[model samples]
Target: MQQMITLITNSISKDLPATLEKSLKKEISSLGPVIARAITPIIEKCSASAVADSIQKVVGDRVVNQLDKSVSAKLEATVARQIQMQFHTSVKQTLQDALRASLEAFLVPAFEQSCKTMFEQVDSAFQKGMSEHTVAIQQQVEATHTPLAQTLKDTISSASSITQNLTAELLDGHRKLLALLASGNAKAHSTNVLQPNNVPVTGPPEVEAPLDPMKELGRLISERKFDEAFTMALQRSDVSIVSWLCSQVDLRALCSMVPVPLNQGVLLALLQQLAVDIATDTPRKIQWMTDVAMAINPTDPVIAMHVKPIFEQVYNALLHLRSLPTTSPSDSTSIRLFMHVINSVLLSYK
Candidate 1:
């Protein structure tokens, strides 16, 4: 039976393709129109709806999602920028506030204290300097001021008289020498005071030779040999000569021509002499002395050292002037300082 079935399957497998193909072509051709008519509208309707659903799902959902994503990103960026701006502003404001607070807390108080301290120091110093000066001057000037001024006047008059006598004597000697030369006697100019018999005269002759130390000083000063004149003036122990030297030597010349340290000594010595109440040269002395004081070099230890001594003498005279009712001006710091530098220049020459 299996052999019969195998034989039959082989025969059918050979015939099946030819017969089935013809019939299948015929059936498909006949059913194609029927299937098209029946299912085409339904398929077309379902396809249209499917395409609409697909478009809505794909395009609309994707657009909404993209818009949402973009909006979120932009919002995030704007928020970040705002936060950054706020943060920066906060930091800057904090720094400024801190600086202001620090200044108010520390720097302002320190500056104010420093200013107050400085002003207080200045006030105290000014008072101290003035008071000490007053006491010292009061102690030093025991004698009446009138006598000193009167004595200065007398001394000046005496000096003038001596200068005149010396000058007259010089002129007379010149005249005598001229007369002798004209008279053909050449020996008249000689230092010897002898008679025609060549013997020494018994008594003092008409015009004695002048021996003025003051005159020698004038010569040195006039010759610009300041150092020598300065030395000679300082070395002389005589009060009158020192006074003479003090009255004569210009402080300006002393400062300009002489070397520093030496000039300092000369200046201090002159100031000392002026302190002795020589009212004769007050007007001349005050102006330049004030200028010298104003121009004082802070770095000069010698000049700085000499200030107290210089002021002692100057204020001595100033205090005396104050005591005199007629010449007393209002109490002024400048006036006190000015009147302290005392005396006149040497004008013994003419």
Candidate 2:
């Protein structure tokens, strides 16, 4: 413990002079200002000019022989002041401008180059770091993916097997059900036909009973029930009904049985379907239109009331058909049928 204390004491002793010297320097720096302040007024009173004049007068007789016996003290002082003033304004300004220009020229390019190099280094480092990070992330993803891919494959395979088994079972059941129905299950397939009275009666179900919706519609029309037939036809959306309805009823007879609005509704439905059929089979539709228009006697006032609206509807459909550009054979045939409809209506009016 004594040796350690002695060693510490030696170290402190070695550093004490440096510490004292620093403190002495600090003290001297602090005193320098006070001393300067004390001497400033005295020094100012004995200015350079005063000092020079005093020295000159003191040494004037002595240096008279050495300094050029022709040069006076006053003349020397004036020359010195003039040189100082010129150097202060002119020389110093020129040197300052030259030095600034030189420094700017030297530093600007170096500064720009240094900045560019630094930026390039930073960008390169950033890119390298990003690339390394990306590589690490990709490696990590690859490491994690094998198990995930296997899990997904297993799950998908299991789901596919389950779905296929279920679908096959459903399809087999459906086929068996259909076959049993075709064989005429007594419980499922009832032997009954609904009559006009809507009473279900047991009868031999007719094989290949025509599934024609228009047949019911024709029966409705023949009964002079235009509204029911029209609703059924519109619900069916069957184009064949347009031709069948046209053939079954004389246009005037249909109008005579139904009210004007009901008659117009039926006519419009027929015309709309006729327009569709004309787009597909123009010649047949045109013939159908002509036959229907002929059934109208335009001169009869009662028929005229019904026939005028049918003509107008046909005219509108014709106008729409004509508006379609005749760019295809179908389009051209449709236009011809439209013209035939217009001509047929005009002839009925005549």
Candidate 3:
């Protein structure tokens, strides 16, 4: 025992503590991981058991056992009241702020609609007033002009009677003139051209056209060489050529002859071609027209019916000329020419 004590004391007094501390420091660095590894399972086991026990106490029926759940109902009611109060005031306040930020979204359109309705009402009233005013003005205008309109209507009505009376008087004078021409004629005309069976009338001695030219004219009329016949007749310097031709030839059969059926308009134009202005005795005008009218028979009621419009036009032209203060020689000649043609050729069937 004494020897063991002495050896321990020497070992302690020797490099045992310092060498042990150095070896322990060197190994402690490596041994720390080993110690942690060894104690980790034990520490983890202890912590898990403690936490499980704590969880079981809290989450299990421990609170009921510990406090008999006396405050749970009050705490739940407190929490619900707090949450409801927060939702009612705080959430509603936030929603109100959001709605206020977007206030113009609905309000602007509503304001525009209200304005539009007001404008439409005003416009309708304005248009209604204008329509009523226009009607009033129209009524006034119509009332003011009614008398003038009636007077104008009456004047127009009387104008027609005046025109008809004038026309009838003019026609009566014309018939008298024609009768005078027939009665007072100084020349003997062949009735063969007008009245085929009438006996010859003895009047003033007349210079007769040559028999050959008259026979040639008859041949041309029979042959239907109308244009050639008319050219020959109009080309003759003597106005008596037309009277002679009408007196000798069947002019209706001559002028109406064409390869194709001509319109009455063409026949009218052809008849008017016979009106050539030649300087001749004024008395011969009525005589030539008389001879032509006898052939065409314009004085006949049936022929006159067809030639009424033509006579009216000729009559109107003459009246218009008379209305003029003075007339050119050409205008007077044209009027006379038109009168001659109407009295003779246009009244013919051709």
lDDT by residue (tens digit), candidate 1, 1-350: 99999988988898888889999999999999999999999999999999988998889888889999999999999999998899788977898999999999999999999999999999999999999998888766745666888987886676656545443443333333223322333333221221222233333342322388778889877887664565455344344665565467665655654344234334444444333433445555455455444334433443343355345445544655454434435343435656543222111111
lDDT of 2 by residue, 4-42 (tens): 999889878988778989999999999999999999988
Best-first order by lDDT: 2, 1, 3
Give RMSD to native, each candidate: 21.1, 35.7, 18.8
TM-scores, each model vs. reference:
0.30, 0.28, 0.30
Model 1 is weakest, by summed lDDT over 10 consecutive residues, at 341-350
Q: After best superposition, candidate 2 residue 274: deviation in angstroms?
A: 34
Task: Supply candidate 1's per-residue lDDT for 179.
Answer: 30
Q: Give candidate 2 misplaced runs (Cα > 4 Å).
A: 1-104, 187-350
lDDT of 3 by residue, 134-172 (tens): 999999989988998898778666654554555454434
**Best candidate according to lDDT:** 2
Say which prediction, candidate 1 or candidate 2, comes out ahead on lDDT.
2
* Candidate lDDT values, in order: 0.55, 0.57, 0.52
